[model samples]
Target: MGVVLAGGAGSRVGGADKGLLPLNGRPLVEHVVARLRPQCDRLLIVANRGLDDYADHAPAVHDETEGHAGPLAGLVAAFGFLACNRQALPRWLLTVPVDCPDPPRDLALRLHAALAADATACCAFARRTGKPQPLFAMYRVDDDPVEWRASARDALHEHGSAWRWHAALEAIGVGFDAPGDAFHNLNTPSDVDEYERAHAAS
Candidate 1:
């Protein structure tokens, strides 16, 4: 399963929904869905607002946790939705933030390989230049959905950082030898403009 976290407050971008922000003549979420759709058997979007608009692209879910808690809240919501609907659960979940319009094409392949390499690792995320991109990650879901749900709740209440939650899962960072802007995420209008300029140049 692939989940796009579009339920953020977008505080950095003046509270505007980053996913709906225009980028290169299309909404940022459109680019993200385009990149992620091919990588998963099923794709879902988690958005607090614009549910109707997002639904046009893919099925959308709202964060179960209140106050737009974070990506973990989105994960919890997705877990619940899958539990109630799917006859069988997916083995893993690949998550990416809507702000990151251009995740690597081989994201699932590399992160899945990382978890396979480590028998005990429950999560794996993208790493570039030694920086962990926790949002672009693959989490072990087949092992114990209940356990992961509890862990996500604990993380949401105790420490809301995705990086910290993945750490608790004994996550591994899969290195990607890609350009510096490979994981670039739009946080502000300037970032949007910069990415658009780069995209046009490319």
Candidate 2:
């Protein structure tokens, strides 16, 4: 299973919905979907707003909790959905933020390979510039998803949106400098413009 995290306050982006921002004349979510869809057997969209627009690209899903929680809330939503739909429970879940328009093509495969190689690893996450990208990661779904719900719930309660997902999952984060541009995200209107200009030059 693959999930796109489009639920965010976009605080740095002047409240603009990052996923809906246009890139190369298409929505940023469209670019993300093109990057991830080929790598997963199933795909889902997690967003707090713009459901109708996102639904046009994939099955739109929303967070279970209110207040536009964060990436953790999106995970809770994905896990809860998996719990209700038992058929996908056995599959691992790959997550990427919708703002990331240029994620690596083999992201899912790389994370899966990493997890398979390290049995003790609960999950595998990617990093760039020596910083962990928690939302760009994958997790094993062999266990009950209710545990994830509880984890997010506890984090939200104790931390009040200050909790980072890498801490929540105790993730085995991996950092690499992939060739060219990867992990480029659209967080601001200027970012969108920058991406367009750079991509056009390329």
Give per-model TM-scores: 0.95, 0.91
Candidate 2 RMSD to the correct structure: 1.9
lDDT of 2 at 36: 90
Q: How would you encode candidate 2's per-residue C-alpha lDDT over 173-196 as one tens digit per residue?
A: 777677556886777788888889
Candidate 1: residue 17 Cα off by (Å) = 1.1
Using lDDT as the measure, which candidate wins? 1
Report the CA-based lDDT of candidate 2 relative to the real structure. Answer: 0.82
Residue 98 local lDDT, model 1: 94
Clashing pairs in 1: none
Model 2 steric clash pairs: none
